[model samples]
Target: VVPGINEIYDPRTKTWSEGPERYFPTYPALFLTQGGEIFYTGSNAGYGPADEGREPGLWDLESNTFTEVGGLRDADQLETSASLLLPPAQEQRFMVLGGGGVGESEESTERTAIIDLTEENPRYRDGPPLPQGTRYLSSVILPDDTVFTSGGSEDYRGRGDSDILKAQFYDPATNSFRPAADPTVGRNYHSEALLLPDGRVATFGSDPLFGDADNTRMGEFEKRIEVYTPPYLHDGREERRPVLGEGPERAAPGETVTFATGQPGRIAEARLMRPSAVTHTTDVEQRSLQLEVRRGAGGVSFTLPEDPSLVPPGWYMLFVSDEEGTPSEATWIQIGEGLAKD
Candidate 1:
């Protein structure tokens, strides 16, 4: 597979096939929308020219129609920015955060933009800004419906000790950010962040351009990883995370699967989280959906949504959260394909 080409691999058929030929910049921030179209958030790697292929829009592969979404502030500075599909997949909202100017121009933006696809003319609106201009910022979705964003440099590649150690938790419901514990290591270019099964976030990899303020010394690749325990998992909330005792290995869409939980009374919500396959700043498969939870005599039960587009057929991490918003260590479950999906 090369640039501007998409190769689709089907595990069931054990074969590879060519997909539609479309031109997209490297590492384009693409998300799977419910209507079966791909949404390009205009966030991409530091390769393309600032004038082309950096507009946020819906790429309808079926008809090859590109509907552009406007209202991005620092449109020219989108390279190395971060974008994500907001939690509770049903919301159909997206957010794009800090980015740098194209091809190492030493320009960066703290601008953040959000769009709600459910709107008739869905265009991006300005969200809160970061503390400073940043690039190569890493973000991950927490099970508690908050997005944890951390570690980026103000310059193109931490060329002048410009790495920002700050981190923040962005709440979707409140549309605000609260400060989080600063990371010990400064992560810049090539850094990554992903959620662990135990509700902790593990961050890895950083390759700065220079080791010192002066441009003479070469930089080193950071191999040490840092695991962050979110606030929900602390303050005696660790023991309160709901535990799934018994359940089936697989469940069909819309089928009710019951499970015995350690603390059923405290159980409030269930989520189907797709384990992410992340590249430095992009994970196209990261998604989470709410499951219909029912309390009964034997135990708690969850019903997967009937819509195949909403709950795609695949293996997912099942997490049950308590009233305190603490989630259990994930249990793997396979969601069977529905008849509606191809």
Candidate 2:
């Protein structure tokens, strides 16, 4: 945990290379967002001063350099603050939600902040606040482009009787939050949530120190995983669900992509979802984009986003949802030509 060193592993070459050292130590609650650029937030430790400056900043992968972005509403580093990249919109934006404040007081906060990356000088502003102060909660992007947050603790270190069992949904279009179904088990401290290919959300894991198997209070660990079916899935439209078939594995941004579908006329929407990089309630890279679709006799055509800054360069799962909101089995597609790091 001291003297943080950075390293990058090349999956193609099966090799590792030393990267420029970080100014501060990296730990849980720290998050990284990826588009063409990568951004990070949260503190270096549970309770302490933040690395470099307290504000979240961008990291240059090519040069291994870090640049601070200005105008943060809350510059003080907080523990377990949930930072996430919202679904693709006119401009790229990131949201930082509830978390515990720094120092021994370690009080929880309900403040929410936003950063617009498209601006010449990106800065954070106050967004819609949460229903209550929370930390260590899991947030995921839904198929409809909204965000859902569940299970967290009201205090730092997740002490006795601090669990938050309710769930909430954030709608960017409305800039407001509403209530959602709660999970049966609590997910605080070490919990996570990820969107599935079929559009359902799977959540699990919670390891409070004294609640693990080694400790006498085994029930507190929360071993069982749970899957949540969104209201759209239960709306009685299963018979009209679309089915995805063969398609190109990759293409560049703005390319016209075509794919086969069993229910061509029934298809209503096409979307691309980036795989989640989730841990400790922070998933900075999870994103989804709606593609413009045109239905043909035997297949469908869609155009990808023209801006590399919006879609980035990576492998994404493509899904076509029917009018009833049922999504097809995902087909993997890599976006853009691979960038040479060297």
Candidate 3:
């Protein structure tokens, strides 16, 4: 229904504008890169050999055109696959993780791929795979720069019997994955996970259709929300979260930004987290980047990334954290052109 007709809504004018035709019918696995370009990796437009030609593509917001970038390593990963824009790096990379194949009994794939967006001809290469094949999982980036993937099904429509309980942490530094603490609830289709300001992750929702029906142990939908406290919070140390005070409401790239903090000595990290836009196991806009923090006279100072591609021109929630991984209350700041010059 989407590729057939595309429309853009303007909040200021409160009007809708018809856009160019889409390259393909996109689904949940759509993400926005640091360069302000949109990319699509997956879709729910049925499955078969015909889908092999369905490759990933990029959308130019200004020109209202879609261009095919590169094809996935495994074409079967075109549905229910989780896609995310990796944290700010020298080269922009987008990752696509586990998802089901074409059939109900078909096993899910643990294979993953990373597309280098910085390249003039972007293409995907083999990346680190998951610990195991999973679909419908919630992936959230921790403040420590690790990706945390939680509950999902091991097989398609197998949530009743193949619910994954344990969580996994993907370390980009080593290009490997390790297990993390498990949550009580089994989050599959329709579930989501988000990073909190305090460095903890909150997971919510589950397949209510099966949960509400079939009054059985396995078929019940999960209505209760679960919060996961990372290992940093309970490392047998006193909790000391940085308290952010006055700071500029807007900033520019390469600018030296200062903020007042009551616990300057405890301030060890500063970061910018883009607001989350999640639905159906897909969240393209959820990204976090570390800022260089230095102790100053009355507070702390940090330089924003010099590259606009790293910190795209938009609004971001700035947070300061201590050594124990406790983050301060988020302060909204506008970067680049969204705000007027002072």
The residue-level lDDT of candidate 3 at 239 comes to: 54
Query: How does each model score on TM-score?
Result: 0.95, 0.83, 0.83
lDDT of 1 by residue, 293-340 (tens): 888765898878777777778888989988878899998888876432
Candidate 3 lDDT, 1-342, residue by residue in tens: 544466777766999998665544345465656666677766442333434435678878788777776656666655667777776443467778877765454467777777888787987787887777877778887766778888877766444467678798877778788889988887776788988766678999877334432336546566899999877666553255567888888888778788887767888888788877777777867878778799977789878776676776788888777876666767788888344323
Predictions: Cα RMSD each: 2.3, 4.3, 3.7
Q: Which stretches of candidate 3 lie over 4 Å from their true place?
A: 43-53, 61-71, 89-91, 103-105, 208-218, 249-256, 263-266, 303-315, 322-326, 334-342
List residue ranges in candidate 2 displaced over 4 A.
28-35, 43-53, 61-66, 103-105, 210-220, 250-254, 305-314, 323-326, 334-342
- Give per-residue CA lDDT, model 2, range 1-342, as digits (tens): 345566777867999888666655335333334355557654323533544434568877777777887665555635677877776543477888887766433477777888877777887788887777877778898867788888887765456556788888888878888999978887777788998877788998986645533334533667899998777667565444578877788888888888877668888887788888787677655778888889887889988887876776798888787776677667788887553211
Tell me, by lDDT, which candidate is best.
1
lDDT values for all models: 0.87, 0.72, 0.72
| Location of the lowest summed lDDT over 10 successive residues in candidate 2 | 25-34
- Candidate 3: worst 10 consecutive residues by lDDT? 44-53
The collision pairs in model 3 are 211-220, 211-221
Q: Rate residue 152 of model 3 by lDDT.
A: 77
lDDT at residue 55 of model 1 (Cα atoms): 87
